[model samples]
Target chain A: MAGGGAAASALSTPWRSLLQRALDGNAHLKHSTFFQLATVGGGGRPANRTVVFRGFQEQSDKIQINTDARSNKIGEIRNCSFGEICWYFTDTWEQFRISGFIDVVDGSNPEPVKLQLRERAWFGSSVKSRLQYLGPCPGLPIPDDDLIKDAHLDPSAGPVDAFCLLVLDPEKFSYRNANAIPWMLSWPSILVCYVNVKAGGAGLLEINYGQAMNAAFKRWLVEVNRKTGPPPQVANGRLHIA
Target chain B: MAGGGAAASALSTPWRSLLQRALDGNAHLKHSTFFQLATVGGGGRPANRTVVFRGFQEQSDKIQINTDARSNKIGEIRNCSFGEICWYFTDTWEQFRISGFIDVVDGSNPEPVKLQLRERAWFGSSVKSRLQYLGPCPGLPIPDDDLIKDAHLDPSAGPVDAFCLLVLDPEKFSYRNANAIPWMLSWPSILVCYVNVKAGGAGLLEINYGQAMNAAFKRWLVEVNRKTGPPPQVANGRLHIA
Candidate 1:
């Protein structure tokens, strides 16, 4: 019911809550829910495509997405399972860049676990969605970058082999809130500067999915929220530091 | 001006024309001109972020871009130079996916060519854009993703070491037009598939920068257009094959 938290939980609580809303997809219409996905292509280059938001898995570790099976992105995923997705909600300038190892869940997989995933994915594939797969494979020399023919398969029959549900198993996350950035690791924060400098030399520090610090961040958030209600500023997506 | 034309003159003219529009950044509003850029991260996962549509350079293979030198993306570019960009116009459903080797030009470079490029990039940057570079480097976990302290640098005083100009040296392109897909590589077009299939199997087919086939494609588009004006259904974003 509350939005943000007290001094100590300032960072973690609001951050988690916002992401949860983004994952939910339908709850809010104020900001864009679409996310841009990035994957390494066969030529070892990074390739990107736009995908609408799908619900996050129960544990919040894996994300689900649907795409045309014949798209070039599928081919890139085939080469490397690693991926990153960037979500930018222009309304509040709130952006989340999540990186993960990706897996394609399609009907072809025979494993029981994979089959279960495929079944769930298949349920989302409407007759219209399935038609995209049956048409000409994308990336072909079509006049425009879309399937030439719209194959309307009977909904009762269900999706064909080309219907693909992509799952992103998150490994890292970069959260940026441009609107309410108050805490700065300035010259006074020598320790932070040292850490940032070290990370800088290595290029960038990736937030590992299972880091002890992340657990600390969650624990800290829970402890702070146990007593205090969400702060006022969070309603507008502001992140106030202690 | 005719839209597309001649296999003999095909590759260069049409290829040049399409890119000129993509590069123009201001000419047409018929479709969404925004492009999504994907770059491989130091951690081996793909990361995508947005950059505004800046004008393209004429008679040059390299496409121009300006970014904060402190941003994680600039650092990512330092590590791996490969990338892919996807553009979609909501109105026409016209999209282009271009892949290329990436490069960044900054104050750090002493080479004549790079320095020249940086100087040109500096002239185009507005004062507001330059301030982003002087502030905290992006991705630093300081309660927000952007710099908390907005450090405004004097425009007359010139840029800090953080202003960077990036260029993408495109190596491949995937053009898809859902509006008028007259050429379907259907079962009948198996021979055409054989050629494209061969190209596909080898993985991403990087355009040789100046390819004869690409030139021919543009020419073929022109030839097709002379007989056919904007097909009736292109406005609704429909894919129809003849």
Candidate 2:
């Protein structure tokens, strides 16, 4: 297991732990988080849309979002194979900007890992959500409100073909205070990390402190694994919590 | 002015008018409005950030957003020359996805029109907003909370060199019902339009209706001016209301 995000001498509680706790769960996580999925479209013009955050896997160093297979974003993801998701839990006064190259899992990739992920994602889906793909392509014209409301599918038949898991393998994480002062003033956050994608490899970490916007912390290629407490050492095979 | 987007027969009220009313002044515009500024970085990865809706120009088919000169977004816009802004005002239950190319005006462009727009934007900016540029480059590390809180400029000195006007020249508009149901179902909104950049020129318009997601309204090269009203025809030059 790669292990490098050490606690800085400045703050009593490490910022990584603060982030981990936020990701672990809270009361207001659902409302505040927005997934930023930007794709390079024609003429290299980027198309960005906000989607609901389905899940985040700290162990795999991946963030998860769901999308309809028929949606424009799926095409964009396939074309670019990279994107970013910005999450702000204003309740916690913290924001995270994650840039990751995407690794998708859908009905096509029927491996055990994919199956486990899809099954887990399916368990979380509501009948209303499962029916999102039953209608025509998104960003297209619809007949009327009544027609749109009536465009539901039979749930007994199980999830449709459009259900997809977009797991973002994060390479960089930018943590910042979501207040009017420091954030607006461009004062850097206390912590930032650049994770190397290589399995069991080290990552770059930077921490800042002191009074006058000083450069207090910067580290290169620290050993980093999935978690802080006793690395699970899942290097041999991938496993997840059900 | 090209006037092809005549009020459609399907809906009792046209979608354009509905949108115009919402933008005219409503309690709900602030939360849902986010400008989608996409710029292709050196690696071709597009950078996207949400900016406040400074204002919207119905007469000249332009939308307004303010940004700092030192911010990364301004650099991206100058590189791309075009971007998109997605606005979802849930209170009115209307979502607008506007596609526009870019035209920026700062103190550098001292034309009367530019000066007027800049002055109007300046009036809307708060002291806190004006102070955003005094800090270091955004997305950079900061030393501490005190450093951030102390990083404000003297109010009497006024706005800094970082303040710039971002006027988006709109080419397309997609307005949809903001209810989670149909919008998630990818059902198209009631009104969509394509505005030609040329003044007093015809633009394409498309409206949808019927029971089965039908395309009932389509107008090619219809006269399209800023307002969907009887043409005052400002074809010779770009004119806007104060």
Candidate 3:
């Protein structure tokens, strides 16, 4: 709530709501050309990777991504919770940078929050008919019809033990326009969001925006949350989303 | 050198020359959409970034790129010398991954390498002008002379101060095709380059039909080096490309 006073003042604007809507209602959100995640490694130097965003949390200021637990990224997050997420919106000529903490969740965990993730896994398996490999590899040998049928005998096969959820709890957020005027370019009007990490805790802070813009953004955030439901929880250092 | 033994036994084909030409003659070498550099950072976590290849050194296995010295990537190289460069050829559905070590050079230093970097910087700045900024204030006074100029001017400005040479002493290289196989769905054979960084700076150990398909790609890498020249060195941890 440190920046709440400033945020409250900006929340009086309608433009904020429009900006928020533009972010959530935009169909091309999933088509970001380059998405980067920066995390502190155990050796303490910052590490980051480009990943596809699976979904967004408008109300909670959260973002969701899917990854294999066996990947190096998971190990980095496990070592350090503080990290940054950057999404380049080429269509809009803008860059959205979010810095926050992350928690990993498993698909088979008993937590109710994980139900949606399990469903997504099932859907993913059905659509692809095989788990995608991360890097280049030799072709998979074709299985006989019976072998193929046998593999699909159980829907659980869809949930590879490697699949996991990565939930980002944003603490600071900024949207930068790279095409802005040269002189006025260094710092554009940015909106920053800070989150309280305690269980069931929520706080919103807006940074450097006019009243109309903040209000518009808040409305959009609320709407996005309503659509996505509550923020998922971290059990055993993993996020479980319903 | 360890992987070189296996490479020699792979195959020898007339297509080797084709692959070599593709690497050395492409005009669009630097502008490829998917160019990535992977370097080891603190704690040994690998870091990768998309970069525009400025040049390559077939003789030394050195690849040069213009970068900001102040960027966090500088810290990454300071911690580890080994790195990997990966290029994704979307048109061909092929990927080339090169692993090597890097060496930073100073542009302002009295070395031939530094002089070459300065020449490139001069060439870049000659055709361009500095970009001026407009006020951030909405109704602030506007300057009549403030206008956008050519982009090439000082393209090396930030990069010179931030840039350093990334000499990839190749330890190993791999070419993989990520496409459906002929007849049945299978992956094409992989062409692995197990280079002895010190023994064969740049020479063909073996080649076959699979590598012939990558002719255009090899030419692209060499083209990058031809155009970019060399990386400026680091003097007291700073680049003097200007």
Stretches of candidate 2 off by over 4 Å are A1-30, A88-94, A110-112, A138-158, A178-180, A183-242, B1-17, B20-36, B90-94, B110-112, B137-159, B178-242
Per-residue lDDT tens digits for candidate 2, residues B149-188, read: 5455565563456668888875655555424212111124
Each candidate structure's TM-score, on Cα atoms with residue i matched to residue i, is 0.64, 0.61, 0.49
lDDT of 3 by residue, A1-242 (tens): 11122222443232233234335434353444236566654445444445556544323445566666666577787776655665544344444556667777765578776656545644543333334321121121112222222333354544555567777766555444433311110113443322222333322222333212334334443443444443443234322221
**Model 1 misses residue B165 by how many Å?**
1.0
Q: Which one wins by lDDT: 1 or 3?
A: 1
Candidate 3: tens digits of C-alpha lDDT, residues B131-174: 22122221111122222123223444443332344455544554
Off by over 4 Å in 3: A1-50, A57-59, A79-99, A107-126, A129-150, A153-158, A171-178, A182-242, B1-50, B79-102, B106-111, B121-126, B129-242
Output the number of the TM-score-best candidate.
1
**DockQ for the candidates, in order:** 0.32, 0.20, 0.06
What fraction of the correct interface contacts does each predicted structure contain?
A: 0.60, 0.32, 0.00
Which tens-of-lDDT digit does each residue in B1-242 have in candidate 1?
A: 11112211332332344444433433354223346788887767687876654445434545667776767687788788877887654433345667787788778887987877777667666766555565444322333223234454556764467677778876766554333343211222111111112211111112223333344344544444454454442324322221
Clash totals, every prediction: 15, 13, 33
Q: Per-residue lDDT for A1-242 in model 2, tens only? A: 01112211122223344455455444343444444466666677766666666655434455667776766677777778877555544344445556668877777885987767875776566765665555555433332324445455555554456677888875655555433212111123333233221233322222232123333222111111212221232223321111
Estimate, for each residue in A94-190, the C-alpha lDDT of model 1 and write its tens digit: 4677777888877787677876766666665454445556644433333332323334456666446766778887666655544442221112211
